[model samples]
Target: MAIYSCFLGKNLKHLKIRLHDIKLATHNFSDKYKTESNGHTTWYTTELSHFNKEKPSLVVIKHFLPGEKDDEEELFLTELEMLTSVKHHNIVTLIGFCVEGFDMMLVIEKFSNGFLRDYLGNVKNMRTLTWEKRLKICIDVAQALNYLHSEMEDKKIIIHTTLHNSSLGLDENWGAKIEDFQWAIFLPPNNKDGAMSKITYSNHSYYMDPEYAKTGMLKRESDVYSFGVILFEILCGRHADDQIYLNGSEKGLIHVARRKFHTGKIEDMIDPTLKEEIGRKSYVPNRGATKDSFYTFLEVAHQCVAEVQDQRPTMKVVLKELQKALFLQVSQLYILS
Candidate 1:
């Protein structure tokens, strides 16, 4: 109660924005301003008029469609509260929110590169990321998770229930930020085993933690499992829900990836574009991962998607391993130059 009250008075008041101003900025949520809508939520990009800066500032507007008023309102408030409480360089910045009338909108700083999910699959609309950039992006997300899990001002741990591709966004410099926190939960530091009984479920089983699915308990390690999926997605250049992974008997990237790893055929799973970079013999230095770095990343990623929750490493360990992998790649580049 104290935690909620403190933020409600000190933060929410200053962060609240009027509905009229948002209407003006988004031109009444015009199609021209709308970037995307996935049925439940619509995203828009516009320069907020009330800011009144010399240069127009771009911001992302998330309009949560109220299907059943009570449920949608709860989700909106959960997201708002989570965003207001958490702060990190690798987490999306919440600028303001409007909750007047039927409108439930959150205004956030717009990232230049957009969602990480956009760059996945065979889509040529987005630029391909170098292995170096991918490693850095993973590191950024790992850092954010570590912060949420251990570094909160209140001695509470946050479990980001839905940590999939869509939950991650990339900035102008390809830096990654974590978003979409409506499903996140907080647990007291003294909670047994740092886990809580699950209250909700996600349909995306590909990213959902197996232990949580089976036992109805959600642990901080659940996020580690999901992050592991993202790591494999980056390495294999495919989404967890991709049709290719779904059609096979193995089903899902985690199953197929682990099988390949055990059979000593893990190299088959590396993205061809990355393979090209790795195999290149040019004297000029490039951004592809060296064998040592690739193996380091692969081993940790493999460990992350382990079936047993206890088998997975903590976010802190994941961050340390990713940093070491990046260092190995960069040091090799220096030697080559």
Candidate 2:
């Protein structure tokens, strides 16, 4: 098996992991070890004993489907470059990679709690995500995006074109981390946006920025737009592809959400569990979010999905607003205690 050293230059040689070990850890990509499988890629979870740690480290191996050699190589190099250059608490960590012959894979730290989507879109699962937990998750993602858009090395920026619920992973303690950088684009210092004439399509149509879709002008605001959709998902306890939204005139959560916000019936859109009431006749265990917290979250999230790109708040602004919302909830708890 050739090491493909031409692509993995001396600088990256240390990160080039052996293919045999990954295959062994994954039992040669056994079906039982597979965690997720889309047409383009497959994910497997396993433990690697070669990290020189006291105990074996759990990891996720992302295997790319074989395609045109040059195209696959370009995609792999792009994603590898982005992952290797960044380090943040709320960003997924790339442990290493395997590139030998036709097999190409990325080894990343595996979170025990799985993707953020796992805890949403289901009534039972949504119950476990209290208002405080949800707020923290959103704050984590916002911090990650702010770092990518404004605080990268040398002041560079990364436009994460693909931002969706599934792109956010959760650790055992429920800390959120942003993952999946295959579709991200890097911009030089001081450059605000890039023109991507050909836009890559994902299953997240509801998260797509309307302005980018209309003009093919990709900007940091596009990510904010997508993050807004995720915030709504957390509020409503539903996915972007939920059938109710798809049946609407504009066919998206953003459309229905905007309509409700304008119609003064925004409270009707909150997830049923989040509407837990404290009536005098009954004892309610969880009273859900305080009015100030709910509306604060709603206001910023609504602004993020605004029709005009210029109206959307920057990630920095979004982070501050979310933090304010979280504070409202925490303060309410303290008062009641």
Candidate 3:
């Protein structure tokens, strides 16, 4: 209890913003201030009233969802606790929060580029993430996961259960900022674990770790599997959501990768826009991404998405491989070209 008191006190002292201030900052919660919402949670952008003629800072406001009062409140506190405890550059920043009346909200840094799901949704937007940018996005999230899995000295193994495209945000510089920790869980170091179920059982299966799904023993490697799904999404430009599976057979990224990944037809899986980008380069291996770069990248993804959890690489290992890929692609990657 003393440990928890310390964390709660630390968080509140620095992060408690008055509800009146938030209302004023968000223009009385006007619709125009809203940037995005998915029915459950809504996001608004605004800055706190200036104390010093400083530039009007932009920030994001996440309205805690309203529902069955008891469950929602518990979930809200859990999420708040985790956000208050864990802070990282790659993960979205929490500026403050408000709990007034029926409204419970978390204040976080706003990312101008929105969710990574945005680009992957349409072929037209695929160009927004050139091959170079795509690799960097993966690297960004990989490092973020590395932090969640091992870098936090005291936060234990924080597992993000919903590590999908929509949760991966992009800031003004187009870097990755992982968010949506409402489903995250914290456990002792390297202890396989699962969060108490918050949603229906079926909805929880989408980003689940298969072994954990089967054995009910959640491991950090579960995140590795989900990251593998994201890696393929970057390479193939598609959603790994169960909707894809429900719509067709042998069409999901995992299905396609399993059947053809090592059979020399894996090249078919690369999104055409990315292929065109690579084709623009005269040298097969531009800077660092060789013609076989997709194979190598997907190879890592393959290991990550492996059906057996034990086969998955640690997030650290995943980040290292991604770094090597980024170095090889440096010549053709975003900054240089």
Candidate 4:
């Protein structure tokens, strides 16, 4: 057995220790990573190193249950290899990994601000994420997706099968970083004839593309559809699966958003947590500052989440649009400053 000590950047002392050492430090591996009632993986907060510690990091230790299938082990190794190969500013970094016995552990860089879901779901944080911040986050995620889809030569057309609010992390600077690549799929090589090129697993109902879910077809367009849902979530400050009050009845946010968008009542979809000056309350604002911003954001969200997947813009295009929106916002801020 070979023991490897890996260091991040130039610091050799801040290396990630082996999983055996980690298990000893924490004690009770099963208690460390308990399974949730829903059967999804649940990680303990104590497993992660303190952010203020020297060369702070996150340790994700997942234990495979007894009689785990071979497919599960393959999936874990594939994900680790994929993450280790790619390095981008907006993509989460894999510090190191250990596959000792039945335990699989991944050490990754820690993001201080938590996931995008926390900011969007919490009413207080929703107001804190201004239009400027939201636009920046959209641009960041779009750039990351674009890199995955086009720029990377080895893994071109990489599909993040799971794209949701929780998979997006926020750094201390509030910039967005795409995380959790365990479900990612890389397209087959050009010379591999008849080789399977895509993966289609059942995704979260809210984020799953109708076309892909029905036909088991995996395409770049599927990512576009999920991106649309994320854009709508950002604009409306509601989960895709959430129900909203609309037209004297409760309906899913998607339904309400589509109807309001078609009827030109786009402003109605804005989250109520935003200030009246930011255009959430009244149809007509005296200053018109919030009204214009809200409408502009709504228009982008509508384009992203269009019913027809073909009409949706690619991540590259989306990134450009978001950057333009951010520039405009910054210019306006400069005038105010």
Candidate 5:
């Protein structure tokens, strides 16, 4: 085994966890303690010792293979940079990390509700995620995007190249959050450089901009495109997959939703659960709350997924639009009740 040590300055020493702590918490990484696995990394439900007392802690421990190439190490550093730079609630919290010799590890908070992929269009949890919960989740995700794409104090753009449903996790209360930032890139402001820099990376074929994928060019709009897919999840309760979009003559959710929306049948795409809710409930002071709110949402989502990048709205604009629809739906549901 390669001997190693982690060096942290006084300011960061508190976050520097010793190897023994990890061992004690995870029982030496025994499979019995493992709760989840993704490729090479594994998640463990363990208790961390804080101030001499053990507290329940849910974390995912990412193990990097020994002797990574230069580029791999650089990518690790970039991920760390992005994690430490962010302090938003809608983004999963970075508990800490470990760097000992050739071995590396990352520890992040584990969400209780798991990924959105678990519920949207899935038989197990679909019924549990009612319309209100789904709407709240959409708002929560929008806030996260607004922070990443618009609220950076350094004026640099942090682009998450992939934003599939699996990358979105929910907390105990169903508050949605963005969990993975491994593919993120920091770029100078677009106006300063005419256009944002390109990311020569890709993953999970479902959600992305065609131009960004083909040209290695990345922009804030790339995330908008992915967010648009997420909006479809909220609207239709569908998950991202080629088959879901390619069902019948539909090329994608955007294509199908666009046609349904233009023809005034957008409600047809709503999940049966929500469809039932809207049909049975006459709580809206007016009959069109469900229709109006759903149309507003579909319109915004359709605009975000526009084939032309220039046609897509900024993250800030998307957030406000979502907020408006959320408020309308929430208010009508309560008052019209």
Candidate 6:
């Protein structure tokens, strides 16, 4: 056993620890330093050494739900195994994990900017996130999902059942990375009967597809729906659950945006702050920030949140559209400057 000593606040404690010790301590430390949220499990750490070899900072820890017995334990272990196997630039990197206890804990690289939800919520001024930054973040997240859906070998379709602002983190570069893969499902290849089977159970409410919410059938398209909701949140800087439509047909932000978009009133659906920013320097009436470039981004977001799952573009297509939007925004900004 390795003996390690660290001061916890004013008290110094010494204990025999394993590799998991680092992860657990890190998790506790992260919680101590960051804001807390409901529904998801997190590890808090005071030090962030796990993120980089040189920089040590406090990090939150997240543990998979423990099962009842050894058989149940295996499921958690398998999830960790699959998550660990994934390595991508836009995806949150899993540093290490502990499966010895009834629960499985994973230590991951902590982003200083925090989750997208926190960033958007804490920004006192709505337009603090520039159009270029917003577009870039959107592209980064889409690319991350594209990698998960298409690039990984052993080729399981990773369904991020909880795709929301809270689960997306921004790194120092302002690039977005997809986090919280615990509820992810690994879909098996098409069977002889051309049916696909899903592994893992999910229970996230806000990001769940209405169809999946009603039927419990998981598919790649379900993730697309959730991603669309995330896109809506990013555009409006509002929670999907908070929006109310005039028709009273449904309450989700995406549904409302879809109706407004079809009626040529998409600007009404965007965040007023973003609209004001675009209008600030406009020389013409009705020509604020809601220009063709801006409209293109919203159209992509609209496509993502389409009512029909099949109508939503894959993350790959979304990424390309976002990249184009970002490039155009940057060029326009340069010309304006």
| Leading candidate by TM-score | 2
Report clash pairs, candidate 3. 193-218, 288-328, 288-329, 289-328
Would you list the rank order by TM-score, best first? 2, 1, 5, 3, 4, 6
Winner on TM-score between 2 and 6 is 2
On TM-score, the stronger of 4 and 5 is 5
Which of the two candidates, 1 or 4, achieves a greater TM-score against the reference? 1
TM-score of each: 0.92, 0.93, 0.85, 0.79, 0.86, 0.77
Task: Rank candidates by lDDT, best first.
Answer: 2, 1, 3, 5, 4, 6
**lDDT for each residue of candidate 3 in 34-70, tens digit (9 for 90 to 100):** 9777666788888775332477568888886677545
How do the residues 153-207 of candidate 1 rate in per-residue lDDT, one tens digit apiece?
8777888888999889999988999998987888888554755565464556788
User: In candidate 6, which residue ranges exceed 4 Å CA deviation?
Assistant: 1-20, 23-42, 48-57, 64-75, 121-125, 154-156, 189-204, 243-250, 277-290
lDDT of each: 0.83, 0.84, 0.74, 0.64, 0.71, 0.62
> Quick one: best lDDT, which candidate?
2
Where is the poorest 10-residue window by lDDT in model 6?
Answer: 1-10
Give model 4's TM-score versus the native structure. Answer: 0.79
lDDT tens per residue, model 2, 1-337: 2325545453776777898998888888999899898866899998987676479899999998777555566666668878987899999999889888888899999988878788777888898888889999999999999999999889989988989988899998999999989888887787755656457645777789888998988888999999999999999999877888878745678899889899988778788877664112232334578778888999999999987888999999999999999998888767766
lDDT of 2 at 180: 88
Worst 10 residues of 4 by lDDT: 1-10
Candidate 2 C-alpha error for residue 33, in Å: 1.2
Candidate 3 accuracy as lDDT: 0.74
Model 1, TM vs. native: 0.92
What's the CA error at residue 134 for candidate 6, in Å? 0.7
In model 3, where do residues sit more than 4 Å from their true spots?
A: 1-8, 50-53, 190-205, 241-247, 277-281, 284-289, 331-337
> Which runs in model 2 stand beyond 4 Å of their true positions?
1-10, 277-287
* lDDT tens readout by residue for model 6, 114-184: 77777553436345666666777878888878877777776656666667777788788877888766556
